[model samples]
Target chain A: MRDKVVTAAEALAEVRDGALVAFNFWGPGTPLHLMRALQERGVKDLTICTNNYTLRADVLREQGAVDAAILLPQTRKIIVAFSGVQQEDSSASVEIARRVQEGTLEIENVSHGLFIERLHAGAMHLGGIYSPIGIGTSLENGKEKRVINGVEYLFQEPIVPDLGLINAAKADTLGNLVCHGTARAANPVIAMASRYTVAEVFEVVEPGGLDPDTIVIPASFVDRIVRIPDDDPYSRERRVEQTLRSVKYRLEKMAEAEAEAAQGGGA
Target chain B: MKEKLTEELVAMRAAKELVPGDYCNLGIGIPLNCAAYAAEGVLLESENGVLGYGPVHDRESLDENIERVDWDIADAGMRYLEYVPGMSFFDMLTSFAMIRSGRLISILGGLQVSEKGDAAIHSTSKDDIASKIGGSMDLSWGAKRLIVTMTHCSKDGSPKIVRELTMPVTTRGRVNLIVTDMAVIEVTSSGLVLKEFAPGWTPEEIQEQTEATLTIAPDVREMEF
Candidate 1:
């Protein structure tokens, strides 16, 4: 078998400007090491396809050392289910808000199901999918609409990205991936949709180490693997710390909202 | 009603609407609370690919050993999810295929519901910043039944059950039922029908707050819970 293990920088070295990148931004499956490498590589005008764009910003904010400046400029457009300011107090990713206002960044806001389905179409080598989800909503603004069996369905084209970035719990030397708990989110689908899939894993074992049944993503779908060092800044412990910090930040925002409401009136 | 129903009570009432063996999708906010009140055999599904999820694992209730395993609690929608015996996880594609197939009943939080059954939940008129559009569109449009759970009025004393939505529509003519702090209403060809009101609240009182014309059910009574 070809050696798939590579450094984060080596794995991401080929990413170019204007490349479409499919990212797993759901929960802990976000490939922060690859993201950091991409930020440092300074590739510009990239289009990111992900579930939520604010998650990376949230993690950086919780870390308190870095800001959105590193990643915002790299992204020219984001096709996602959730984008923009999240709360009444402006608690969401500031970079997204700023870019959207400046008209520098474009957003194609589709429903979560459609977002996944689009990627799935790409992965499965299907031309497109017809669904009733976006029918009369803004999601169907420019999409082809078809009536099948007396039901309106919107035709969504496939989304094939140039690169796919994902994080996983473990990977065999051959690039078979095993996700931990709910962190598996969109990694498996993303792996199949991109031309090159780079997996950043916590551990890399021998070829026969990972159980076949436990491997959610096969080696055939992965092009490269980067093992995150135990003491790396983006290790599991660091992610947990960042998550807790984000929770604390959210609680604080909620408290502040409550205080402001109390000041307004009893109602 | 003498006092508005608590968020938990509103969720409890919404939970009662779910039948056994139903596949349900609960949105963020008030709908997330419904997991606690779910009926037997009602499996909760998340858009991120989890099924048969149980109620939130309160820190107090979680086993000490399990708490040590780092779980991403930043996403409030998934923070409270407890893995059950038959829990299964899949890719987002499969998760959404189940949703778009109209096999799941969606319980969602809404900003406004028009008499025509159109719902506006994604964006608000006051949003000068970028608008956030989550799974509201798909859940509303493709779910077998869309149940909207929200407070009757906004914080500024405006009725959410309006004749027409002032905000951008999330999905057109998709809402099946509207559950609020004051009343439970069903949207039908005739318009918003007042099915049940909270204790001490009359149809007239609910009508006073609702912008849409309400037709009181023939057997309208106080909510059982």
Candidate 2:
């Protein structure tokens, strides 16, 4: 059994250079404190993996913590799927894209289906799995294709990170963790696939404090717990923007409708 | 039909029959207009995470503080949309899940439709491949009934309704209905059946705009609206 308590920076200090790190939560629910701690510890040459590139843009860059990042191509910048603007331009995508173009930030672009399949395969402890998701596309490069029963299957390699960072809303002293809504995307899989895992929780209580059924992430996968007393404003902001940007095109469509209606009425 | 396309859309809305609670999607270009006149109780689900949405609200009244997915200005039609957060590109998987789960009732989009019900929205050339297919593939295979909306004739007077799609298909055998400015064609196991045509357009004219041979319905009426 591992000890349950540690300072966020101390927990992050354990990450070695060139290790692959995966973080839970996209925006604020991410273990920002731990990320910040890692930055302050002067960690370098690390390969960071997450659904998105930046946690809180300000915090990540200010600390200059990340040496490199691995992400899907489509996941590179947050753009309104229709209009193509940086989701919140002032915050992250622009800078990250700039870095990517400058060759400072590396990317590993995977198709939407293939990425989840990779994680699911990693969680299952399976060897590279077979699927036709990337068969003839650009993603097929560096991949092997095999025919079974006259059907072709593309072989995608598994993704396993060295350290997993997650944000838990609640956890017991034994290191079992739980996440609020929308935090489950890559956290559970990352925790299971990583070599070591650390979590930042809003509250750390005695053993048995959290019900067994309520736990989204089990304690057996956790190695350290860091308590974050307050909610993250950036994460909240990301959630709100995500909701808005997703609908921005629909809104524009509405505006077009009103214009037509006005013209029809005038005629 | 001043702006031939816009007038055609209004006609399509009036002619097409919509069932209440049908999970429908309006694709990016042409189908986007369909949402404006969606009948009551018809929930509009966007790939970015909105369901049971209303029409777009006034931009002047927009909240500077509340932004969605990419932190852009969200419209009223977008309110009550759920947010799926994730690592770098993970939210996309969730969005595709919503599409591929066969939960989407109907999907509306623009395209060149083949007789096989294969719809192509990506591009006519291999050079344009990186233009982003978005959720088209997911929606094509996932939605129960896929509808393709486009002009019957291409700009050079070529046909979009083809015997075989010349472009790479987003999905195979996914299209159920094809609504054009001139008529409505449903792809059946046998071939293309002309379900409805606009008032005054002849079967020959419809066939002229189509590369495929069209079979006219005996009781075809001027597309209702």
Candidate 3:
């Protein structure tokens, strides 16, 4: 069997300028190290499809955790699922808005499910999924619509990205992956949806070291595995602490609102 | 003459819809308070792919339910959660599958609801610089029953119950119920029916606040619990 484990820079070499990149951003499974690596690689004119377009980083930073913010110039276009959903006007989101206004970047916004379903279509090699998600809103524009079972549904097209950057808790030499918690999200799908898939993993084990039942992404779908450099085990612990702080912050705000309402006669 | 219901009360009213053994997803903002008031057996799901969990309010609760706590496992709103018994996690695709399959009842915070049951939970500016339509579309379209918990009026005090939606629509004719600060409106084919009003607020007062004409249910009464 070929050696699939390589350094982050070596794996990122496969990514070229103008590549259509895909990132699994819906959960803690985001390939943060790989994203930062790509930003360092300085690939230009890349069109990236992701769930959150740099919005997560800003939120994390506010909570005092160091988020891996990819500040790549000439990103060209971003096809995002959730943009400022929390109504958070983060610097990254603000920059995206500014870039759009400056005609420096283009963006395509789709609903969360359809975004994944479109990628699933490409991975499964099937016709695009017919979803009624955006049928009513302005999202109905320029899409093929059909009435299936007397209900109107829009046909979404498959999007096979040139490269998929994914994260995993562990990977074997043959590239079988194991993801932790909800972090398993999008890793399997992105591996199958992209032409070339590279993973940023916490650990690299020899083949057969991992039980077959434990592997989430099989070896065949993954092309390379890069163990995150200088991996700190305390990273998640710090983030958890920060999350608790934010929760306390929310509670404090709620109490203040309640106090204000009480003084205002519940108006 | 009387006070309006608080955001927490609106969420409490919405939580009544989540009986035991029901799977539920709550939107951000006021709807998030539904977690605190959810039925004991309710399985709370988040778009980030967690189910069978409850929101973690502070460190003490986290330590109490810390058996399988994955600190990295944050909810869609970026809130850390407590992993209760029977709690399991899945990927985003599977998470959304459950959402679009009519298994989860969603309580969402809406921007507006039309008389015809059309919901406009998402909004975007004309500049079209960036649009954020999260799981609102799927939830509104596929929830077993969609209940919107919001205030009756916008910050400017304009009615959110409207004759027609002027904002970006999320789903057409999908809202089953609306629990606002002033009243509980049932969206029917005929019109928006005023089912229950807050204490001291009458159907006529709600109708006056609403942009669309409200059809008062024959048995309308003051909201309880």
Q: Rate the local accuracy (lDDT) of all candidates.
A: 0.80, 0.60, 0.80
Q: Write the per-residue lDDT of candidate 2 for residues B26-124, one digit (tens) a residue.
A: 676567666666676676665543455555544433455344323321221233323333211223345556666777755455557888787776456
**TM-score ranking, best first:** 1, 3, 2
Better of 1 and 2 by DockQ: 1
Q: What lDDT tens digits, residue by residue, belong to model 1 across residues A1-267?
A: 568999898898889999998887767577887788788888999988878755433444555423233466788887877754443333445656778889998877777777777888899999888877767666677888999999889888899999998888899998999987667777888998999999999899998998898889999999999999888778877766665555566666679889998988776
Query: What tens-digit string does per-residue lDDT give for candidate 1 at B1-225?
Result: 279888999999999999899999998889988988888899988877778877565533333435544474223254745556998877677777787778999999999999999999887863534336667787787799999999999988899999988888888888999999999999998899999999879899999999999999999989875
Query: Candidate 3 docking: what grade?
Result: medium
> Which 10-residue span in candidate 2 chain B carries the lowest summed lDDT?
B68-77
TM-score of 1: 0.92
| Model 1 lDDT, residue B108, Cα | 94
DockQ of each: 0.51, 0.15, 0.52
True contacts kept of each: 0.54, 0.06, 0.67
Tens-digit per-residue lDDT, A1-267, candidate 2? 557788777687677766777764343345666665665666566665555432223333343322122232213322111111133422445655566677665556444445555666776788988865444444466878899898667787776777788776788988888766444555666678777888877788998788897787788889888877455422434335443443464466579989999999899
DockQ of 3: 0.52
Q: What are the chain B TM-scores of all models?
A: 0.91, 0.80, 0.93
Query: Which segments of model 3 are wrong by more than 4 Å?
Result: A56-72, A85-90, A231-267, B57-69, B124-128
